[model samples]
Target: MAKLLFGSLAWFSFPSFADNKPLNSPVDYLSVLLSLVVVIALVFMLGYIMRRFNVTQQGGGQMKVVGSMALGTRERILVIQVGEEQHMLGVTAQNINHLAKLDSPLEVAQPSGDNFKDKLTQLMQGQKGKTHD
Candidate 1:
């Protein structure tokens, strides 16, 4: 009787005791792949929305990023134009600090103010021009 009770409990605990087949279903794989694609698409959509509306940038009426340079992964220097005045600011993940107010606003070749992207575009254009020349 004890052995019967133990075997019954074991059968309930161990699924393999009732069914020897493994859980290798095609539907399961398809479901996982669909879920992954949906999640990736959602991330991209959110990013586009944020950039499109400037959702992360508050009080963007007068302030414009004239220039920006990354000091580290999360720290950077930004030159922002407020009306006729341009102010240089030090920005980090934590807070923003006023560095100085520029008498003359720096010339920006690209209005986006991402220095790396602007520089890359310049380098690519230079190389393309050289190839053509």
Candidate 2:
């Protein structure tokens, strides 16, 4: 009786083992591809929804980044305009320091006579001269 019971259990388990075949059908591959595409689209949709709702964004007010300059590898200078006032801030990897609050917002000067590359080269050269002096 024990042998008969074990045989019946083995017979049921055999079909389960046989069902574990590698995915060899085009339909199986298509289903996997479709699932991957769906997951990627869902992630993108979630990011878009969060951005639309300003979920991870800072300062929900009317403050805007007017300009930014990199001072060093880990340091930056930011000019932020809030209403009619502009605030200059020195931001490092360790801390954010308030540099100044301007009474009147500074206007961005338009470059003249040269392209961006020429202006950048001139600026770099000027920095080198200043360092040498």
Candidate 3:
């Protein structure tokens, strides 16, 4: 009874491999590495193809967002350029409202002289001064 039980346990403990190769062989590792590289390459290739075809792009036709500002947690003002004209719109979670049409579109100002970190430090200092007063 002891011999039979030990034999059955030993048979179950070892897995049966059809190829008769060691589990951690170089060929297995090479195959796994090749498969990972192929999968990563395929993903990047698919992304490039989609971007090239504009399949995953937003607002590429006639309308473009010129500027936007958030008024509240759920409300925002957007300046969108359509064809040759620009329109201001009030956007909320529930609805969108057309505000006005501007003769010239708002141009984004380029930061000069100070870098972002310096500007941020100045803004923090200004806010602190305002709070003290």
Error of 3 at 68 (Å): 0.3
Model 3 residue 76 distance off true place after TM-score fit, in angstroms: 0.2
Give the poorly placed runs of model 3, Cα more than 4 Å off. 1-57, 108-133
lDDT of 2 at 106: 80
lDDT of 2 by residue, 1-133 (tens): 9878766756544332337666677766676677679879999999998756546444547887778888887899999988878999999999999999987788854557375566999998888888532
1 against 2, candidate with superior lDDT: 2
Output the lDDT of residue 75, model 3.
92
Say which prediction, candidate 2 or candidate 3, comes out ahead on TM-score. 3
Residue-level lDDT of model 3, residues 38-69, one tens digit each, is: 87999999999875654633466898777878
RMSD of each predicted structure: 16.2, 20.6, 19.2
What is the per-residue lDDT of model 1 for residues 14-112, given as tens digits with 9 covering 90 to 100? 343346456477765675577679879999999998766546533548777877788998889999888889899999999999999997678755556
TM-score, candidate number 2 = 0.37
